[model samples]
Target: MNAEREIRGSYWLETAPGGAPAPPPAGDVSVDVAVVGGGIAGLSTAWELARRGREVAVLEADRIAAGVTGHTTAKLTVLHTLVYDHLRRTRGREGARLYADSQSAALRRAAEVVADLGIDCDWEEAVAHTYAEAPEHVEALRAEAEAAREAGLPAEFVTGTELPYPVAGAVRVTGQAQFHPVKYLRALTDDLKRHGGTVYEGTRVTGLTEGEPCVLETDTGVSVQAREVVVATHYPIFDRALLFTRLSPRRELVVAGPIDADRAPRDMYITTEQNTRSVRSAPHADGTRLLVVTGEHFTPGAPGAADVEERFARLTAWAQSRFPGLTPTHRWATQDNDSTDSVPLVGRLHPGSRHTYVATGFGGWGLSGGIMAGRLIADLVEGREPEWAGLYDPRRLASVVREGGTFLKNQAHVAKHFVGDRLPSVTSPAPEDLAPGDGAVLRVDGHQCAVHRDDSGQLHAVSARCTHLGCLVAFNRAERAWECPCHGSRFDPDGRILQGPAVRPLEPREITSH
Candidate 1:
């Protein structure tokens, strides 16, 4: 395969096409609970609430499960790449135990749902490994294995056997899983509907009025009144609690293709090495498995970061070299918000919030984290107290001090981009200098403009400023989108919002082609 060939979109979405499109709300709507995203977290929470006899409604800006969840590597496990060891030190033994128990419980709940619904989502039980290639990192792997086992997982240190190359050491955990995420979520959506839960696609909630009954205003001028609201829009579109300060957005590239089942590794694997290489496979046609490899994490649109195309190429090359004769057939990118404390915020939206709640900062391990968020959020909304709720509470302040170094590092990165992007020296190519199918941020009449030249030589110009926080947008040439490095707001070349914390599109700017 040509290394420069543009790869197809997500395999899960391609294989499991969504059902008939659900039209946006025609007018005013009312529900007992309103969920503001359609990914795993939101859909899971809605399904749980609907099962509990709550009148639930899910509002999605795009098709359900077609966003980050669709692009995930789809590993369902309690082992999150040495997280137990880190939590054991920072949050204590009890904290690590709670983390493990919560994640394991979530995984069990997912299994029950799959069995109960009789959903054929290619569910497979397998082992999970956190491996290290460097000899120096072997001790860390041993510590992680011990920590994970102490935290109540079936974990042990071992030298991995499956990969083509040898690893110095690996922390292996059994009883984990991998599956087809889209298929699983689609079935869940159908079940939610069966429980009288309403899902409105293409309905972007732009405004929220907090009161006895929270009022959510959609972009189409429809109002949704609900007693409780859950903002699970990945990055938390409404940031009244200033989550942006604690959460940093990371973008990673994925490359996958079919490999003979006999040749593929049977277990899921991840490593902090090579910027984070996460490996997993799912059932495919003719006794073949789709070998999925993910890595090359970077802050979206961060200045001086490597080019997106180069990143994709590097990831693809790494995958092919690691697994000889493995040809990549599909490639896609996914973004996740990493909380400073490395725990997801899954409860109240903020301290002042009464009827509103939020779930974000899942980092890169959203599959299990999302399921955990769903159960926790439902419990909170129903006025039931779960023992592990405080661990993921958005209001927890003690982590701020323990994890202050990470917090400061992320904030400093964002602060640099926020302030440095405006410097005159940080120039973008002129519109005339751009070739077809290229984009740049150019200064036009004292305004920073995001300009893209299409294959037909037509230039589309929009304001360079991101609507979320006035941060300058950078062009991701491989994806052909303007991405905000600060908060992960993504907009198409034509100025439409793709992903967000930003509810509005980039403003169109008047420009002249030379």
Candidate 2:
């Protein structure tokens, strides 16, 4: 059970090329641009820069497309859940129109790239829906449809939907597309290489410094000096910019399976209720129609989160309750940072540092957001001012002025956890007391340490303090990893860094046998 618990697959990865030869890691190759991630943003940046005849290199901590892009439902639509109405209320009509234009442009850009490169990704165009499961949300859906149409989107309201269960009403946006995300991203990578770009896998960047050529220090002790840098690794890894305070980390679960052709929804859909129902479909490598469902976000290590195993169980139950015949073939979870305001941060890292740029805080709209960020980052590097740059500038404080209360509350929560987690272990379970395949935070040698007992009954221990910001790391029983409560950095039980904000691994501790 433990072996199968966290071994969930993605439909994109299973259908796309599994094993391919990776480019060799070079010692030190300076380029005109060095993109720090290989997902949509990084690859898109490289692709765009290469088109403009600029020398670019992409440094990936993991394999290309293995980050959030691989885990997405792969919808290429601007039809976000209840966003048009909310934006209209907060950002005004013009701001909302700019957002709609950028998102629509992103959708167009993706379609253009697919046609230009002749990529073999399985693409399909379908209408998108934002439906209400509860009665109270019907009016909100209608408002959303009206606002979306006002903002120049092809949106309308309808009482009937293609979902298995009945919905109160839905806002429909036509001409949206969906495809295999990994396959499309893989083509982008191939196009990058063909346009004189270089890529390095397994390269983890640790620190960044301002210089004539900004220096990015990697975990392998290599220095990447670039005229301009784009920190596109999902969450901006830099802490000095204090971007973490403005961004809140969220985790969402996804479960997909082969369902009958008749059972599949004719269009991609989402719900307006608090715990949204994000649904889409794709064909697996064997031509099996896979239905993907994602929603119910929570902070990774927050007390409110379900026990790691329970999260997956709930996801399975959510699917079985809706589509009873689904035989699940893929399951996984993704972490994204939500910005203070609705808009993502996508300009320079800080006011003082013009060379260092970051694109984060997508708030779960990464498929469209990442592509838009890539283009924006490219424009910034070339000194061409994109129209939407002012809205997404990292230093812009309109969001802070409007949403200060929520930001302060979120920071206060962080401050509480930082102090609360270090005080003492309320539940101290000894190493010998833990069963095989279990873990806990306990007082080890008077120190609060994360201890995991393997199947062999051997204890593995590491400092519970998160390397990113000192928040206590909680044991994620589902993935058998330690996850930071505040910033969403993750580490293996053996103390190796699994994800970041934290490039450094957790400090190893000596565990005396009991």
Candidate 3:
């Protein structure tokens, strides 16, 4: 079976119905605190602030919980794949301990909220594993298990798992979890409203002016004035801190399908091999459970359509071979930012900012990291410092120096795309050469134009240069969107913005038939 044809949209989004749309702010709005980006981080932070009796408003560019959070595999585990050992080496044992403690606390906080709010989000407690199929990597797994145990986790090296395949070694950490992220966040949004918090959908914050009362300018020409602002737009739309330099964007594909409850793995699993494979199961309808498999890490637009389709094909093949009779019903992609130091940056937006805070660089583990960020930002807003705040502070220079190699590497990669993408191409495709349901970057007249042909044979043309930073955008045929190889900004074939970093839509370009 072709993975591309068998795949649909996100399972979570298709299953969970969206709530009534909240209208955008009419004109000027005032709130004690404004949380931007209504994913898990924004809503979680808004709810926390509301519970503390602070008037808050959540501004979402799109629907709440319908962005990255919606597409996530929804693993709420403190055991991020192979992170403890790296942290223990780069940071000291105490720093590693703090990292574990903070993430575990976030899990507890989520549990407490679930219980308190009575959210029926199909929450399930399970162990998590980081396994190595190769014997050569067994020692690395053992070291990770030991490091995790030293960091105050119930972790141990094991050679057995419920997975059908055999593993040379695995680091199993208990007390981890998986849940329906959308349901939980929707309930949290409702509860936030109950506590006098406001939410606005279709409101994209475009500019920020920091002051005693920071002002947020939106695309709708409305302004939001707040004492404190949290920029949780996943990739941090505002890069005043030069966060783009330290953060590397990665996009991963996911394929999920229903499996017999008895056949499903009892716990979550991740392996760094094969790009990166993360597996987990969620409660589904009837007697079946949805088995979610995610892998194929690539920079957005770096891979061609054929490459992406091959990746999906490979992932589907792996899942089917491991678990017989499992067919993927859904396939989607999620993007994340990895910090240079491998730790999430969850503090002040910039070094000079007094009221703005940003949360980003979760690598691929944003479920737990976002929750932790919500709590950490809330504490900082309340003028109370969280004990683990120092570890995730965006202002930390020591870690940046220690991880300079990664920082420079990411910059070098981006520089290559930024500079190399500008040189005129010797063999640019012509718009007429594009077949139906295909796209290509063509030099129309003297400019690079992203041109696509619809299934009906109609041609659509847009400027190839990304609005974010002038990097040339490439066509992603698998998703039918133009994505920036640098920074991951995505746009529709019709020149509309699908994701950002880039608030503005792509410019329409005219292409006359030759």
Candidate 4:
């Protein structure tokens, strides 16, 4: 079978000790709270609601964490790439402080959740590091540290003697944390089941009907009736009229491999480079593990590997140059929604959609934001006002718009794709042009089409144009599927829709060889 055809595969949570894939929702059911998308966010929210004595049910298109959660680097930290100063300047000092406070509280709350549940997920309290190898960016690091201090974060600046290399400074966040995301989630999911929460995998939510009692419909001919709904799908499962245009999608890469424990920094670290490098180590069954990674602000359908194979190769070479005899073992990549503003959007879907709530735009730090979103969303579900509600409201002006970049940058992307498709093809690709495990866009009879060659050398072809807006879709090596660089509509290699904004699959383009 073609790899792209087989959606079933391994997820970290599904591989955990004594872990079982969440069963699909069978037939119809009614529950007080119907949670859509069984990732960390959904599971976390369901568990929280269940513990509070609510009848909760979760529905997922695949196993838990099989989506973005399965592909995360699992770095649990408050330092999310030079965000403090940026937030301070844009959203104000109070906004920055609140953002920092929310993340810190989430970190502490995660520790408490792990301990209270006694989940053996390799949980540990590790220091977090934000460094700059470029001397020019050292002041940015210093300013971030100052902002962190102002935000009430326990952060300090370090330089020279502190780093394995470089002349600039670094910010060390003490008492930050790290863990095996799937393992920790496994424990929490089990508790959710025990608390009368229902979890269903392989259940895809197709559309939502808004009313006093909202209805969530699944493609499997099952419907969930609930007073409240939580869409924890990495991207909002449905479109928000205006918010959709505000947040842009960013793709990232993460590679895990062997490292010399004696030489690697004891803490996890990230830098201030444009396509930044994040260094982190976790205790695996073998020894200390290293995640050499890159990728930020990538257009979804753009040409590239999600893991930034080139960047990872460079970072690994640098690592081995400094600390020899280490190699990468496991590698993967994922994309997350980056909102116009740095903060996530967590609240009612829109002003009038009172019964439905959504948690999205974690950027890349979905762990902390996921926890915080679960808390805030659950509060809204229970008819209670949450302290962090205003900070994460989706209705707020986008950071870019507020800062005067949204109009130009967004128009640039739209116009570039809209007109760029008119340009000539780089090359006219034949069906035989693609080797096994390869895919490309080809001009077939004056029309562009997407073609994929499976490992078995079977060629599958579909319309290259995205149904949503006619933008060309690109092959995503990380997800092993076709994605739209414009609006992030994703389809399986065979052209079946996996995500939306594009409601139809690309029609198969018949191939005729010369």
- TM-score for each candidate, following the candidate numbering: 0.98, 0.96, 0.98, 0.90
lDDT, residue 156, candidate 4? 87
Can you write out model 3's per-residue Cα lDDT over 223-261, one digit (the tens) per residue? Answer: 999999999998888878998888888889999999999
Global lDDT scores for all candidate models: 0.91, 0.84, 0.91, 0.76
Candidate 1 local lDDT, 1-514, one digit each (tens): 4455556889989998566889999889999999999999999999999999999999999999989999888999889998999999999999999999999999999999999999999999999999999999999999999999899899999986588899999999999999999999999999999999999998999999999899999999999999999999999999789888999999999999999999888899999998999888888889998999999998887874439888888898999888888888899999999999999998999999888999999988899999999999999988997989999999999998999999999889878877877787555567899888788889888888999998789999999999998888888888889999888999999899999999999999999986
RMSD of each: 1.4, 1.8, 1.4, 3.6
lDDT of 4: 0.76
By lDDT rank, best first, the candidates go 1, 3, 2, 4
Per-residue accuracy of model 4 over 234-304 as CA lDDT, tens digit each:
77758754566666777665555556565556667787575767776666545555544444436678655
- Candidate 1: what lDDT? 0.91
**Model 1 pairs in collision:** none
Instruction: Evaluate model 4: give its TM-score.
Output: 0.90
Report the lDDT tens digits of candidate 2 across residue range 406-478. 7997899899998898687667877889788777777877898888888788889889888888888888776
